[model samples]
Every structure is written in structure tokens, then in C-alpha cells.
Target: MAKLFGNLELVLIVGLVAALAIIGAFASSVVVDANSILRWLHLFFGVLWIGLLYYFNFVQVPTMPAIPAEQKGAVTGFIAPKALFYFRWAALLTVVTGLGIAQVNGYLHTAMSFTGEGAVNLIGTGMWIALVMAFNVWFIIWPNQKKALGIVETTPEQKAAAGPRAMIASRLNTLLSLPMLYCMVSANLG
Candidate 1:
């Protein structure tokens, strides 16, 4: 495996294989079905999005200034772009699939309502926050990052401005993520 694939590609391939195996198992099981598969996809994508968000906040941002200027280009110019591509898209899919689950499970309105106190309120709050973060990922950060990373052409000043905007929005999402995670987990609590 090491001879055939670099570390990153190998890791990605392994993850994909594991995901496929889980899906296969679900398909084979009488207890699981398509809806279960979709729910799993939602959860999987949500983890990917939030996981990347944590990576950016907990690891990447703090380390950037310390990275050598020459190497910063590799991180910012290459790795960051690839990671953000998956990050933003995963965010989008998470929202889509989560909503799909809510609709399928017939709890869309109930979950959104925050009707009862306690877990309902908490879960509703998290759902709303996640929705906002997803919106920011798609509508705000991704667009700004395009300019920041020169995915599209822009003046240096514009790129500089865009970078901070993206960072701020990313951080905002990171901050909301804690509450979002809490609500998501607590929502299912009996």
C-alpha cells in the first residue's frame, strides 16, 4: 500500500472502502434499508464538514503564522484549497441529507419547532445554527475563498481582504459548532 499510494491517498481510499463496506452491510441487513443509508450519509457528511471545521480552527489557523513563509504557500495555496473544497461541499450535503432524514422520519416540523423545553429547545437551536453555518459555508466562505486562493482572478488587495473574511466566517462557524453538536446529540436523548 505504501509503495502504491502516498499516505493521504491511501488514507482516503481506506476511508472510502470502510464507508462502502458499511453501506453494503446495511443493504444486506433486514433491519436496515435505504432510509437508514441516507441517514448515515447525512451523519457521515456532517462529520466531514464539522471535522474539517475543527481542523481549521484547532490546527490549521493556529499553525499558519508559525509555518515558514515558503511552506505557507504549499499549505495555503494547495492543501487548504483541497480541504475547503470538501469542507464546504460536505457542509452542503450534510444540510441536504439531514433535512432529507427529518422529512423521511416525519419530524421536520417538530424538530424545527422547538416546542417542548429541554432537549427540543437544544436540538432546535443546534439545527438552526447548523443551517446558518451551512449557509455561510456555501454563500459566504466558499465564494470569498475562491478569490483568496485565486481560484478566480482578483487583485492582491481583494485576495487579502477575502482571506480575512473567509477566516472570520470559518471561525464563526467553528464557534457555533459546539452548541450545534450539543443540540444534535441531545435531541435524540430520551
Candidate 2:
């Protein structure tokens, strides 16, 4: 039991299989179905991603320059990497779950359309913005971060490029978040 629990991959696989079995059984017994569960996962992962995002933007980044140079590597090499692992994965999951929710709720097409009533158009704009942000996360940000963190080797020029790429996209996400959040919150109000 100890050995089984010790391997993270194994634990995750077991947990995932158990969760699927439970969900399968529950869905078979219930009428409402599993969309709610997907939505719940979306919300859970979104909160985790955005919460860490704000932490990095609003807290960690600002504090970094203040730390002594000798100690900086500890934060950057160790702590920051771990945080970023979760951050990127959370962001990925957030996007996946969010799209799942939209699809489950039958809003994917309309939200992508940018047509229909005022509220729908508004929601669509937000959806588009979120989609762009997610794309940036998956494409621009994650790839750059790998180089920036030495997760992948690169030239100084490439490393330099990574910083700006990641920063700009993150800032763009920050900018989009304000309006995106508003549209999402107001989505059901109408």
C-alpha cells in the first residue's frame, strides 16, 4: 500500500480509474447526467489557474527583484519551477474544462458566432477573448517558459525572446481577464 501510494503516476492512475468508475455508476443511476461534473471540474481548475495567475502577477513578480541575488536562484530554480508546473497545467485544464462546459451547455457555437442577441454577442466576445488567452497559454507562454526556465536548452537570444513572449502573453491574459470575467458573470444574468 505504501509503495503503491508512493508513486505519483500510479496514484493518479488509480484515482482517475476510481473516479471514472464512480461517475459511470452515478450517471447510470441519475437522470441529470455528467455535464454538471464536467462543469464542476472546469470551475475547479479555472479557479486554481486564475488564482495562481493573480498570485504571480500581483504578488511574486513584484517581490522578486527585492530578493537578494544569491537567494534568487532558489526561488527561480526550485520554487518558481514547481509553481509554474502547476500554473501551466492548471491553465491547460481550465481551458479544456471551460470549453467542455460551453459544449455541454450547448453554447460553443453561439459563443463562437459573435451573432444573435445583445447578451449573446457580449458573451461571444468574451469567449473569443478567452480562447485567445488559452491559445497564448498553450502555444506562446508554455513553449517560451520551457526555454526561460532551462527546461529546454537554448541560446541566450532564444532565452531573451522567451521572457518577452511569456510576459506579453501573460499580460494580455491579464488584460482580457477583466472583461472576460464580466461577460462570464453576466452570462446568466440575462
Candidate 3:
């Protein structure tokens, strides 16, 4: 069991197999289809993206000042780069899977245009917000973070500028997450 759990890839594979088994056993009782699968993927990616966002905001950023000057390198050089890689990709995947779900459900246009019913409009609003957040993740946050973390070569002045830019963008995403989540959950309640 320890060996099985020790490898993340192995654990994920086993978990997927277990999920498949459970889904197979309950196939008759549940609606399993393209939209459902896309939604599951979207949820997974969304959780990863948002979880990391929250971790950065609530934990890492707040604790950074308290970290020793020498030890700051551990986070900036190693942990941050890794976390940002997952964060950016997860943000992209979450948007893609979400859009896929909207397309599969035949509401892509309606939702995107905010034209159909109340639920559609709500979801559309959420989609727009998420798109903005994803945009920030890719365009603003990641680029700035690369410089800030010293992944990209830059002067000390530029590096100092980059850190605050990334933080502001990340904080913007965090702020938007609240209303986006409300729209998503409320729209799906029916």
C-alpha cells in the first residue's frame, strides 16, 4: 500500500481504475456521456487551478515575508516554478474542458452570447469571468512570474516590477473566482 501510494502517477492510475469500475457498476443508474465526462474533467482542472491560486494567495504570498532571506531561494527557485507550471496548464485545461462541456451540451452559443435562459446567462457570466482569469494566468501572471522567479533573465529593477504585477493579476483572479463560482454552482443547481 505504501509503495502504491508513494508514486503519484500510480496512485492516480489506480484511482482512475477504481472510478471506472464504480462507473461501470452504476452505469445503468447514472447518465454517463460526453458532456458528463467533459464536466468531470473541467471540475478536476478547475479544482487544481483554483486550489493552487488559493494556496499562492492565502499561504505562499502571505508567508513569503516571514521566510528567511536565504531560504526564499528554495521557494522562488524550485517550488514556485513547479507550482506555476501546474497552475498555468490547469487554468488552460479547465477553460478548454469547460468550453467543451458547453459545446457538447448544445449551449455554447447561447451561453457565450448570454442569450438563452437564466441558467444559460448565469453560466455565460461564469464562463466570461473564467476566461478573464485564464487570460490573466497565461498572459499576465505567468510572464511576470517567470521574470520575478528568475526563470527569465531580467534586471533587478524589472524583476522587482514583475513580482507585483504577477501578484496583482493573481489577486484579481482570486477576486473573480467568488462570483464565477457562484454563477457556476447556481446555474447547475437545477
- Leading candidate by TM-score: 3
Q: Write the per-residue lDDT of candidate 2 for residues 49-161, one digit (tens) a residue.
A: 77877887788778987999998888768977888888888878877776677677777677778656777777778778877878887888788878887889999999989
Model 3 TM-score, 2 decimals: 0.97
Q: Encode model 3's per-residue lDDT on 26-76: one tens digit a residue.
A: 889999898878888899999999999999999999999999999999999
What lDDT would candidate 2 get against the real structure? 0.78
Q: Comparing candidate 1 with candidate 2, which one achieves the higher TM-score?
A: 1
lDDT score, candidate 3: 0.94
Error of 1 at 43 (Å): 2.1
Question: How many steric overlaps are in each model, in order?
Answer: 0, 0, 0
Error of 2 at 16 (Å): 12
Ranking by TM-score: 3, 1, 2
Q: Give Cα-based local distance difference scores for all models.
A: 0.83, 0.78, 0.94
> Residue 21 error for model 3, in Å?
0.9
TM per model?
0.82, 0.77, 0.97
- Which number leads on lDDT? 3
lDDT of 1 at 19: 78
